[model samples]
Target: MKINVMTDILEANDRIAAVNRQLFDSHKNLVLNLMSSPGAGKTMLLEKTAQALRGKLRLGVIVGDVETARDKERLEKYDLPVVQLNTGSACHLDANMIASALPHVDLTNIDVLVIENVGNLVCPAEFRVGEDFKIMILSVTEGDEKPLKYPLMFRESSLLLINKIDLLKYTNFNLDEAKANARKVNPNIEIVDISCVTGEGISDWAAWLSGCYKRKFGTNSLA
Candidate 1:
């Protein structure tokens, strides 16, 4: 009975996700669902990405958190349209939560819509939020064995951002081993190393994201 109930829930979620996908397709916008564990730098990456793509892309952000509006406030500094979805005590953001926030965003004018899912490595990956791609961020501080311990996020994501590289010297994290484990689970996952503090490897990440947007929307410039 429990298994059946869980399946039904996912089926319903998928139907709603399809509707959201159609809405985004009609507006010619690319939606990216970003997932990560708590304090994995998802908000910081969004801030940096928004800043880097400023003027080049009509970007909008939808931040999901269990309660506070902290992430939304950080995104607002980019001066772009953003909505905050406080899920109360929910551990993850689902398609329904995203649908509820759609009314506050101008989807037609937005070239890229980034949904920063509630900071979680597990359940977020299990739910589809009507995104063209899923990107996951893993901080070196989270340990190198995360890929093996929590393989689902790495397996589900199209891109992985290995963040906090600036702290690598202070930790015993093995970059190669982490990448190897992730590849074993998902061989085609595109990995980009970045450090929000030092602004390292951000250009590559931005360029890749731009390419993805172009591939999905068919134009190079979001403007």
Candidate 2:
């Protein structure tokens, strides 16, 4: 009975997600769903991305958290259209929540919309919020066993950013092993090593994102 209820809920959410996807597609917005555990550098990556892609791609963000609008506050300085979605008790942002927030954003103004999902690896991966891609961030300090333990997150993600590589010497996190483990679950997952602190790999990440936008819209002009 419990499983049936959960299944029904997901079905409903997927239907809403389809609607959201259709709306984004009509506006030619490349939406990215960013997922990670707490302190995995999701917001930092966005900060760097906003800086890197500024004046290149018009950007919008939907920050999702369980309670406070702290993350939303952090991103407001960029002067982009930023919307905060406080789930209250929900661990993940569903399609309905995203649909509710859509009115707050001008979809016609932005080329890319990044949805920063609640800082959770498990539940966030299970829900689709009408994103073009599911991008995961795994900080090196979190250890390499995550892919093996949380296989679903790895499998569902289109790209995985191994962040905080600047602290590689201080931590015992093995980069090779981590990549190996991630590929074990997701053979075709694109992985990039990045450090938001030193600004490493931010350009590569931005280029990849831009490439996605270009591929989708088939235009060189981001603006």
Candidate 3:
């Protein structure tokens, strides 16, 4: 009989993700698993987030890429505790990869642990990596039909950041339509229009993050 190996792998990954979740909960760290397609501004968002939260949050970043520490290098300027995870042939960051990196990061003092998953809309959304929130970045340059084309990513994410709004004037993308389509897939998803380059909506993003961090950790200051 034919077997679904993918199901078995996902189940195993989820178990590990549960364990990782407990570990993060113990420290009260708000772990956000960020996913997007290539050139969706994930790195720039991280840089801008770090800048916006400067004295308010203590951050740690784990960058997952198919190869190279390129994204990690880009984030180094922020001075956050950054770890680079090269997934080799793997296209997504599974729970085991996160488990492997946990020890390398200083979680005790971290208020938030951000996992910038490898740039893909499919597999990353399927694998659970012990995150409190799954955030997806959709740039207007990708066009507005993305929510329908990539329904799973839209459906699974807790927050959707409609990034690259700075390019709206140049593209045929409809902002309201994209937001409405995303809501169709996931009614509960919280979304924001942002441009990491122009520093727009970053303060709101940071404030949301800080509020979530405070709620999760139950503290106002970085411990």
True lDDT of residue 11, candidate 3? 87
| TM-score, model 2 to reference | 0.95
Writing each residue's lDDT as its tens digit, candidate 2 over 1-223 gives: 3454435658889999999999999999999999999999988898888899988998899999988988888888888789999999999999999999999999999898999999998999999989999999999999999999999999999999999999999999999999999999999999999999999999999999989999999996464
Candidate lDDT values, in order: 0.90, 0.93, 0.91
Cα-based lDDT at residue 219, candidate 1: 91
Residue-level lDDT for 80 in candidate 2: 78
Residue 99 lDDT, candidate 1, scale 0-100: 90
Report the Cα RMSD per candidate.
2.3, 2.5, 2.2
- Estimate the lDDT of model 3: 0.91
Q: Candidate 1: what lDDT?
A: 0.90
Give the 10-residue window scoring lowest on summed lDDT in candidate 2: 1-10
Per-residue lDDT for 37-135 in model 1, tens only? 999998889888888887888889999999988888888888988999999988999989889999999998888899999888889998898999999
Model 3: clashing residue pairs? none
Ranking by TM-score: 2, 1, 3
Question: Candidate order by lDDT, highest to lowest?
Answer: 2, 3, 1
